[model samples]
Target: MNHQKSSVEQQYVLFKLDNEFYGIDILQVETIEKVMDITRVPHALPYVQGVINLRGEVVPVINLRKRFNLPEVALDEESRIMIISIEDMIVGLLVDSSSEVIQLEDADVDEAPELGEQKDNEYIKGIGKNEDRIIILLDLKKILGITDTNEL
Candidate 1:
């Protein structure tokens, strides 16, 4: 009899941004909150939606659509704020909607395709295959410009 342990699977929080699907590692996500009032900040980056008071902690929020340079659409009922922690910084990412959580083995992920001269693609970690759709896995740290100590 052969007893082999299965490979560990990674979990991801799936969200929608425009018409596309994106996935973020579940470990990085702190919580998901409904769209709330965001206080606008002066002279902030275009992607910075503003700050939100999350249980007393003021968290900076970023609109994924604007960060990705996608066309802007009015916020709807499905809008959500995904609070995630990268390194020691906690930030909120405004997404169209968070649908489900999925698990995938390392083998199911493929390297992101090369889009020459497109700097936006730099934040993509990989493309994950699941059922009939593909999920673009994002490197939250890179997207937020957090450098790992090991990388230094």
Candidate 2:
């Protein structure tokens, strides 16, 4: 089998958060939209910015900047929400901007290296570096509290 074709089949939708580019499995993505009015949920986690009404469906939006503990970047014309599903939860991740989907071979993906003492490390699955940029693959299950990591 051709390596590139296999990678393309895996499919990923890439987006920018802070200064980094990250890729989430396209299978998990439901839709993408421009920044919408989000209603704040009292007592929610800081990263959990709030919720938005999507054609009658209430979806929680997460500020990737806050989730990663990075400096907040004010939303502007380029901001977007990438709606993704993890197990049973539908999450909207706010990204600085959306990038094009690039096909990369399995060989291009590698297990994420330990960053040491950073809480954000728990969310990263592996690092995929291409010719010009690195795509930080996310472990959505672990990141969204779907899987228990206390044992690890």
Candidate 3:
């Protein structure tokens, strides 16, 4: 008898920032929320928009556009906050929009390429190819500057 190994697929939450597409492992995502009141924290990182009371727990919110040094745009109806859990900490990511969940086989992802820039590849985990679109898979831990979740 011959048996073939089944391929495991990973689920990702896809979102848009500027014109580029980005994906994060679905397991890390807690919930997607509409843009709401964010209380600004003084002396916090510029990318950190502030904190919000999420279901009684305070969570820090980071603006992905500002985090990536991209051009800032006004928030509209499509703006959303993706609450994700990283180890012991829960944080919110401000995104332009989150559309769908996609499944990709391990083979569909390619390691992020060296772009010969200072920090261009710092936060990228890999490049995920789906149909004609190339989704930049983000390393949330790195993007959030989270060295130790316990520190949060």
Among these predictions, the greatest lDDT belongs to 3
lDDT of 1 at 38: 98
- What 10-residue stretch in candidate 3 is worst by lDDT? 1-10
Clash totals in order? 0, 0, 0
TM-score of each: 0.92, 0.87, 0.92
lDDT of 3 by residue, 10-119 (tens): 99999999978999999999999999999999999999999999989999999999999999999999999999998888999999999899998888899999999948
The superposed Cα distance between candidate 1 and the true structure at residue 53, in angstroms, equals 0.5
Q: Which of 1 and 3 is ahead in TM-score?
A: 1
Q: 2 or 3, which is superior by TM-score?
A: 3
lDDT of 1: 0.93
How many backbone clashes are present in model 2? 0
lDDT by residue for model 1 (90-148), tens: 99999999999999888889999988876858899999999998999999977897777
Cα error of candidate 2 at position 131, Å: 2.0
Badly placed stretches (over 4 Å) of model 2 are: 1-9, 118-120, 148-152
Point to the candidate with the largest TM-score.
1
Model 1 scores worst on lDDT over the 10 consecutive residues at: 1-10
Error of 1 at 64 (Å): 0.6
Ranking by lDDT: 3, 1, 2
Comparing 1 and 3 on lDDT, the stronger one: 3
